[model samples]
Target: MFHSVCQVPTAKVCGDGKPSRRGRSFIYRLKDEDQVPQQVCKLFFLSTLGYHPTNDSLVLSVMGKDISTPLAPPKDQRGRHAPANKLDQKPLHEHIESFHPSVSHYRREHAPWRRYLPSDISMKLMYADYIEKDNKCSYESYRKAVKSLNISFTQLGEEQCESCLLQEQHVKADHQGEAAVNCPQCEKWQIHKDSATGSRLHYQSDAERDLPEDTSTRSVDLQKVIMLSRMPGVKSAVFTRRIVAYHETFVSVGKKTNKKNTISVVWHEGIAGRSAAEITSAYAAALEKERDIKHIVYWVDNCSSQNKNWCLFSSLVSIVNSQTISTEDITLKFFHPGHTFMSADSFHHGVEQEMKSRPGGVVFGCSRIV
Candidate 1:
């Protein structure tokens, strides 16, 4: 029997090429110019490089205009101008990518572990040099060195401890043998509080005592926080005290400064922390004088009397005006809690160490002042 034969097409025109032609054939438009070719190859455009189109040699066709230029934004005459930068909010993303080092060569260390002491830098360098990347043995060596140096946990190098003997000597010599009043908690019996008669009363407790007694020792310490309140260009300090006796201490502390002229007001051993008018009068007198003292920072702790006693505040105000000081020039501020012992000041530290020498001083004195 004779059968009709049909020809099979070639593989190149299958059409799964650029832009997904999917086997489409084109008819010449309107047979315009009747001279058109009978068969036409399709043109495809692909964006990604280094990839093949299904049929490698696709024909090129002319396409339309520019695509990159962005359209202008819509006008919003009624809308307000762009909000300020401070008003912008951060964008939110679903997830984050992060990388961790395969080896932890730089381990965390506690700063101020031993009070910033001055000590050998050799062990630090030695451990740093030997620590190998991703090597357990190197880490073990570092641990061993840390234990050997006894400085592994404490970042202190044994040189910067403010309570060191060398530091104390330097402070005393610098102050011309006049020492600071150490924090009462650390200074032991040397911490003195004046009774109503203005006499010295020492309180004692070893400032060196610390927690975990058997394994480590906490050296006793003291910190003095200086407070000041200033207005505009002028500054004045207000000494702080918990009780009335603090006024006496404040006056005494002032006496410790280099005094070229004598203070007009006399010290009243019998009556202290009272007589607001008298205190104001004294401040006014100081303001009237033209001393070399420029800006003053008077540190004062929280006292109800400061607000309760109208006379004292009034006195301060008058003094500010008389000293050519503006009311807003002075500012008053407090110190952080429990940091008084760490202060580098002389009185705060001295008071702590001296109490170590005095016996039975803590029996009658308080342990919070420095």
Candidate 2:
């Protein structure tokens, strides 16, 4: 039955202008002269082979094959030899891995798993270095390998010292002169940078010190003003005016035990502005909670209108003099204007992350942030 259904009857070409290839080639008929319609023939052929009628081309190909020829086994290429031009990735990967010694690793104090490379060391520079070593790999392959390793570059902080910025500008200006060797601006810039570095080291030393049980170190900073009415995935929300909310974070660290306690005071712009009076009030409230400690050291930024003003000082004096407060000594250490990245900033970062992860990213009121 299968042979009868798939039989291809051939006929010689009879009428031709010349004895070309087409004239000599055998012409095969798809069906017998009295067979069923082409569609029904296809359906019958497919049904016998357990194939759908939609595969008419396949059915035609099979039916058109000469029955005189025997079927040959398919040539399997599995387990064949690898291509000669295929690259050996082991050496290239080792070269890329060698970059580990050149770059510094920094782990986030809050999230230890979140490691980062220095901001200055970019992929382009690393790839350039790799090429200098005569490594044989494309930049794209190197980038994929780095990405697979979960290596990421650290972003620059939001705040930078104004003094450092000015000094940089001055140094650039001094370099254009004929005698750039002994420029006073270069000396001054170096002094400013040294001062900033010293202050940061001193703050770190104080924070890491193991002190008496009666003393505690606290780092305080005002977070960036958060805008409310943030609705994610809403196009119109971008144009609307948002309410501003102020957050003051105080991270109290136990010098001896290395324990941390974070306190956040949140308020909207309608309640009070970020004036010295408001800041002093917040500081007093934070201090009120630490009355049990005999000595408290505060690390703050050098913002005269906020932490460095006489208003905050007078307020602190009043708190210390008040009989209700048990604090015997209060010390306020100010970090350099542009280099105040402290524990409070980390706390604010955590708060920002939490706010972003809220359902629908909808923040209607200031209380929602709390």
Candidate 3:
């Protein structure tokens, strides 16, 4: 069978009566004894030997080696020939770490470890600043390094100070330095920052202050409206209108015991609107649970339609003068505008994380959100 498929042609004799070695070549027959094509026969023969006919390089490499020698182990070429322009990881990491000094931590007790940069700062701007200092890295590399640090650009639902934002815009618009130097907006921005800092300090002090047995401090905030029937990564969900749910959270810290209590009131739009009346009612219900406390210090944001309205004030007044409750004095303190970071906000963040972590990343109804 072998002689029928392959034949070594007779070599021409050289002048010295020796057969020429180069002319003795094997001539393959296109058809075997069964009239099968040589190509199909070659494929079947390779399969029997556990080799793929399509892998020409591997087949040729194996054929070129001596039968007595074993195949050498494969070599991993990764990272062996790096580009000359590859950046040194040390300086790139250092540049990214330098931004940590400007990063701010969340004031919420539950999420105190969460850090964020200013809203105006972004990876593009950070990369620009880095390159200005003669850093040798691409913008993509800088952005990846920054993301690996687990820092966010801003907290969810964070509001920037209007005065500071306006001042920055004014400074950028001004061509000459004289206008920005004596700008009233700049002065107002300074005052606004100072007030915000002071109010934040006061809130912390009150939250941590040791008080009498009957006194307590609490912070309240309404979370951003959550849309139900949430199906993350579903293209169809984008255009569809979803049910809106409201969540109002109150985080109370006891003065003597330092124990923290969290209360969440959730409702859909079909049940009640997020008007001042509904907010007041929900807060009043939370207050009813803490009737044993005589003096309550309430910290809240300055939303006119909710916490700062006359309806909520009236409700609080009625609670203070109630015959059954032990609440005599209720001091309502408002955080500085655009700087209202409260413990209640942390509860909302937790709820958001929970919703995202659901199986299939889908929430079918409002009840599932609760």
- How accurate locally is residue 235 in candidate 1, as Cα lDDT from 0 to 100? 28
Q: Write the per-residue lDDT of candidate 1 for residues 297-351, one digit (tens) a residue.
A: 3333334343236776666665556646433332232222212221113333343
Q: Per-residue lDDT tens digits of candidate 3, residues 1-370?
A: 2332332445588789987765433333345689775633555555555668554354435333343344465578888988988777787778767776332434433445556776677888788888998777877888777777666675555565676567667777873433344667777777887898899889878877787778778788888898877777787886788889888777764354765466667788999999999999888877777788888888998899988898999888888898868988999899888788776666677777777778344332222122
Per-residue alpha-carbon lDDT of candidate 2 for residues 125-182, written as tens digits (9 for 90 to 100): 9888888887777888878877766666643245555666676566567665332458
lDDT of 1 at 201: 12
Better of 2 and 3 by lDDT: 3
Which candidate's TM-score is highest? 3
Model 1 is weakest, by summed lDDT over 10 consecutive residues, at 92-101
**What lDDT would each prediction earn against the true structure?**
0.30, 0.68, 0.70
Give candidate 2's root-mean-square deviation (CA, Å): 16.1
Best-to-worst ranking by TM-score = 3, 2, 1
Candidate closer to the true structure by TM-score (higher is better), 2 or 3: 3
